[model samples]
Target chain A: MVLNSHQRATIEAAAARIIPADHDPGALEAGVIDYIEQTLATHDGDHAQSYFDGVRELDELARRQFAAEEFSSLGPEQQDRILKLLEEKASPFFSLLVRHTMEGFYGDPRHGGNKDRAGWTMLGFPGPSYPKGYSSPLGWYDGHLPDDFASPKKRSDHEPE
Target chain B: MSRNEAVDVCIIGAGASGLVAAKELSEAGLSVVILERGPWRQRSDFAPEDEISTKRRHFFWPTVEQEPRTWRLNAQSPTEFLSADVQVFSNAMCVGGGTVHYSGLSWRFHESDFRVKSTDGSVAGTSIEDWPISYEDMEPYYEKAEWTIGISGKGWSNPFDPPRRRDYPVPPVARNSAGAILENGCRALGLHPFPTPMAILSRPYDGRPGCVNKGFCSGYGCPVGAKSSALEALLPKALATGRCDIRPLVMAREISVDSGGRAAGVVYIDSAGTEQFQSARLILLAAGGVETPRLLLLSKSSRFPEGVGNSSGLVGKNLMLHAPGPIVIAIFPEAVDGHQGSPCTRVMQDFYKTDSRRGFIRGGFVHPRAHGGDPVDYALQPVHGARWGLKHKDSMRESWRHYLHSHCTGESLPVESNMVDLDPEVKDRFGLPVARITYTSHENDIRLGSFLAKRSREIFEAVKASKVIVPPSRLRKLHNHQMGTCRMGNSPGSSVVDKWCRSHDMPNLFIIDASVFVTSGGLNPALTIEANAFRVCDYIVSEARRGNLG
Candidate 1:
C-alpha cells in the first residue's frame, strides 16, 4: 500500500512502540503498520470507515487550530500536541483507530491482520493457549516477561511529545 | 427417482438447545439435517473497529428481522419500535443461536425454579404449575450439558445453591479489578460473591483455545471456538458425523398436517425461493420464542383454527420476559479495567431466594460484568459527563481505567395480557403476519424492580464504591431472554403443548425452545432452554423408536 511518508512514519512510530521486540521479534519489523493499512483498505471492516473518518477529521481539527499545513510539516512536539487535542475532543474515535491498528498489528492471521503471530512472540504472549491446559512448563514466562501488560504506546499515554 | 434430500432429522435454529439436541441425536445413527436462519460468523468476525458491530449491530445472527412483533405499554398504546438492547428478547438467526454472541454464562435454575408454584406458595391469579420435571430429572443432563458445551468455572453447592453433581470444568475467570473491589466489599458485608459458572474455555479444553481477554466478547462470536456455541462447539461435532446435513437459508413456512391431524411434513421455502415439502414422521420445532409461535399460528388447517397447535388457544399467550433490573455502576479509585474478564464472571444470588418481604413472587439475578471500554463505549461513560474542548480530552485520558458497569437481570412476573398475537395487517419480508407483541409490566413489576434497585444501591455502597449511579425505575425493556409463549400443561385447554412439548392438537409435532418455557427463569433463559432441550431430545429419540408419532 502507498502511504504518505509522514503517515508511514507516524504509523511506524506507533507500530514500533506497540510491538517493542527489543530482542526477539519487532512490531514495525513484523510489518504491523502495513497490516493496519491493508486491513483498512481491503477487509471492508466497520473499523475501516471510522479510521478513514478519523484521518479526515484529524486533519480538519489540526487545520482549524494551526491552518492547513501538512501534519508532518509540524514539528514533532506540535504533532504530539495535535494528537493530544484529538484525544480530548474525540477520544472514542482516536482511541478506536489506535486500538484497531494495534489489534490488526497483533491479532491472529486468520482474520487477516497479524500474519505470522509475530505480534504474539514480540509481546511474550505465547500463541493461543493449547488445549492441554498449560501442563507445559513456562520456558519463558518463568519470569522473562514483565507483568506490566500495558503496550508501549499506552505506557507513555500522557507524553504529549 | 433418486432421493434429492435425505436426513432422519432436520433441526432448525442453531441455538443453546437445538445444537445440543442435534449433537446427541446425530451421534445415534440417525441422519440429521440442520437449518440455521443466520450467518455463521466466528471470532474471525471481531474487527473491533468503530464500525459494524458497535454501530450497525451487524453481528445479526440471521439478522434481527425475525424478532417477535411486540408492542409496548399495551393494546391501547400503538406499537412502538424496540431496539435489541432493551429486551434481550433477541434470538440469533445464525448457526449458533444466541450462544454465538452470549456472555458464556451457564447457570442452572435453582431447584426452586422448577417448584416455584409449590415452594413459593402460589400467587393470586397466576397459573404457576410446578415444572412437569424436577431438578433431579435434569441433574445428570445438566452435567452432561455442561461437559458437552465445555463449561469452565468452579461449582460447588455454594450454601445458597441448589443441588449439584460436579464442579465446573475450569477455575473461574479471574475477577477483574471491579470484581476484586466488589468481592472485598461483599465479603466485608458478609454477602456471598461466588465466581459465576461460565461456558468459556478458561485454560483451554476440548478443541478450542482460551480467552485472550480482548474484552468485548459477549455480543460477538468467538472465532477460536473457545466460547461454547452450537456452531463453534456442538453442531460442528454433529456435522462431523457426516450423518447430519446443514441447509442454510431455507425457511419453514408451516407444518402440513395429514387428515388424521398428525404433522406429515413441513412446507419450507428453500433458498431458491421454491416451495418444497420435507416429509417426516416426527417434526420438532426449535424456531425460538418469537417465530415458533408465529409459525404455528400461521399453519391454520381444518383440524386446527388458532393455527396448527391452537386448539388450546394458549399458543401465543402468557408471553413472559425476564425483568431487566436497575443497573448501578460504582466507581473505584483503582483501575477497574472491567474489559479483562468474561462478562458474567461473578454474581451474588442473595436475592434469588423466594422472598415475600420484597412483595414479589420470585427472584432475580444481580451480576457483575467487566464489559466494553474499547473506545466508543468508554467515551460515553457517565463519569465522563458532558464534553468540552479541554474537558473532553481530560476524560479521554482516563478512558481505559475510568469505569466499570454492573447489571441486574431480574424476573418479570408473568401476566396473561403480555403476549404475541398476529397483526391485523403488517407483514415481514415474507408475507406472514407480523408477530405483534403487546406488553406492559404490571404495577407490581415496577414495585419489584424499584425494591431491587434499593438492594442494588446497598450492595454498591457496602462495597465502598467511590461513586454509585442507580438508574431509576421507568418501565425498562425486557432482556432478550423471551419465553413462555407455548407453555406446557397436562390439559390441552390450559397449555398449547403436553409436558413433553408435543403439541396437544397436532400430536406428532413438537415445539421446544424458549417458546415452551412454562415460566421464565429469574435470569438468562439460554441455559434453562438448553437443559430442557437436552431432556426433551432424550424423550424424542426414545419415543420415536417406540413409534409414538402414531
Candidate 2:
C-alpha cells in the first residue's frame, strides 16, 4: 500500500497535465495513480508491475540527466523531455503506468475512476442508450422525453430545449 | 463422505443457460437445484470503488487464485501460452456468468447457417460440419425464448435473419448521432445498415426498467435493471416459483454414476471448501462451451473412460470463437459521437455470405459499432495528426468529433489442432484439470480476414472518409464468443452428443449450449444456444414421459 513519495508526486503532476483538472478532474484527483498501483499489485505478473517499476525508473531518468534535487524540482517542460526518453526506451513500466492512469480517468466511475461520470459528461457525451426503434425510425414513446430522465438536474446544462 | 441431498434435476453452472434450464424444468413439475461454483454477489453489493476487488473487477464472485487457463498457438510453440500482447482469454467466474459483464449484442444465426456443409462444400483443413437441426426446426423456440425472456429489437431489420413467428417483445432504442452518421455512410455506399439488435431493455418490458443511458455498459452490469442479464431476467422469477433450490458457491466436480449406469449424483465442493454430494435423476451441463468439455473430460469413470459420453472423442475438439477484432478504427472530420447509442446500433450483414472467390467457405458481416471510448481507450486509437504536447492536445479537442470504427466478424475455421485439453500441470483449487487452449488460425481464417478488410476499405471509400486505418487483418477476433469442443451430430461415432443434445454414452446426460454446435453459424451463438437447449429439452421431456430415463 505504501507508494514512493517523490515518485507519487511526479506521476500525480505529470498525469495532471496529461489529463488536467481544468474542466474535469485530473488523474490524481480521480485516484488514477492509486488505481494504477493497485492494478499493478495483482496484475503485476504481466507488464503492469514493470510499469510501477517504471515510475521509479522515471525518477532515475530525471536524476541521471540532472542532479537529484534539480531534476525533482524541474518544471513541466523539463519533465516532458524525461518522458520523451522514457517513451523512446519503450519502457514497459512507464507505458503501463500511463496506460492504467488513463484507464482510471476514462473508465466507468463504478470502477472508482471517472468520479461521477465527470470525465465523460464534461465532453458533452451521452451515456449508453437503447437501440429498440421497434416501430419506425422514431423510438417507442410518442417521441418526447420529460425534459430529462425523472430529474432535470441530472441532465446536461446545455441540453437542447 | 459428506451428507447427500436428493433432487429431481441437478443443473451445473449458474450461467444464462443454467438459469433458463432451472426455470423450465422447475415449471415442468420437476425439482431443480442449481450449483454455481462462484460465490454470490448481488447487484447492490457490486461497488466500483475498491481497487483490488472492483476496479480490477475481481469482486465478481470467483477468485483467480490459480493462474487462469493458458493458451498456445501451436504445439511447436513452447508449452507456455502467449500471456500478454494478445487478447486476454477470459471466462466469466461469477454467479450470473458472462451475462453479468457482456456488451449485450444479442443475435440469432441465419437459416443457411445451420446447413454449412450442405449449403457450401466441406471447409478443408478443418471439420466445419452442419448442426444436427436447422433454423426452421428451432424457429418456434427462438420466438419463445424472445418472449419468455424479453428482447428489444426492430424485427426484420436484418435481411439475412431467419423467419420469425412473432415480432420482438420490445421496441429498439433510439439511434444516436454516431448511428445516424454510420447510417448515412452505409446508405451512400448502396448498403443497408439497420438497427443493431441488443439484449438491453428498451421500453421497460417485463419487470426491468428502460435504459438510463449511463453509457458505461461493458465489462459491468447495469445497476438499474436495464440490461436483461440472467440474474435480472430469469433466475429471480424461477427462484420465486419455489420449485428450485439455488446453491451458490457449490462447484460440481463430477457426475457420479451407479452400477446400472445412470447419473446417480454429482459430487461438488461448496464455498467453504466443504465437499458435498447431490444425487439427481437427470444432469444438465449448461456450463458453457469451454467448461462443459473440460468437466466432461475431467469426470472420468469406469463406464465411459474417454470422459463421460465422449465415446467419439470429440469432447474437446474443433473449438471456435466469434472473431471480431483485427479491424479498422477511422477518425472522421465531423462528430460520430459514438458514446450515445447502444454499443452496437447498426450493422451491414451484406457481406455475410459464402463466396468461394474469397478463398473461404464462410464470410463475415461488416458492422458499425459505437465503441465505449472513454478516456482510457483514447490513446489506443489511431490519430490522423501527430501525437505530442500540442498535437495530443489538439487531438483531444477533436476526439468528440473524430472517432469512427467498424467490426468484422469473419469465418474462424474450426481446426482439430485448436483443441482444449486438460493441463497436466495446472488444476483449479478442487484438484480438477484446467483447460489448456491450443489454437492457430488456418489459411482460411487469414484469407477471410483479408476479404473483410478489402470490403471495409471499399465501404470507407464509398463514404468518402478522409482517412481509414485498416489493420493488416480486416477482421477483429476479440468478440470471444467461443464455441464447439463437444459438438452435436447425427452419429455417435463422429460427435459427442446426439441431435437431442443427449450424450451418446450417458443417456441421462445433456449438454445444450455452444458446446453442442457442430459449426458456429457465422454469427453470435447466444440466441441459437437458447433455441437448441429448448429443442433438446423438448426431446428429453417426451422421452422421460415414455418412461425412458436412459
Tens digits of per-residue lDDT for model 2, B1-550: 5866687788898877787787777777778888887665677755321222443444442334543465666777655532422332354656677777666767777777888888886756888788778888888888877776677777887677777778888776555544555565667777777776777887688877887544445556566677777777878877887999988877787888889877787888887888889988899998887778888888897677877877888888888875443566666555555554466656667778776675667777766555544445554444435433445545566664456667777767677777887888877777777777787777876776667767776766665556777765422222346788888888999998888888888778888767887777666666677767667777767776787874
Instruction: Pick the TM-score winner.
Output: 2
Which runs of model 1 end up more than 4 angstroms from their true locations? A1-161, B1-6, B46-55, B61-70, B84-89, B380-384, B387-393, B474-478
Lowest lDDT 10-mer window, candidate 2 chain B?
Answer: B47-56
Error of 1 at B462 (Å): 2.9
Off by over 4 Å in 2: A13-56, A68-71, A75-78, A107-122, A125-161, B43-67, B81-89, B380-390, B460-466, B473-479
DockQ of each: 0.05, 0.17
Q: Report the C-alpha lDDT of model 1 over B57-77, residue by residue, as the tens digit.
A: 445533335543546667778
Local accuracy of candidate 2 as per-residue lDDT tens digits, A53-126: 66667677767886555334667777777877867887665555565655666565654466666555655554
Candidate 1 lDDT over A37-122, as tens digits, reads: 66656543546556545556656655887785655455545655666677667666666555554455445554445557664444
Candidates' interface RMSDs, in order?
Answer: 10.7, 8.8
How is the predicted docking of candidate 1 categorized under the CAPRI scheme?
A: incorrect
Q: Write down the RMSD of candidate 1 (Cα, Å).
A: 8.9
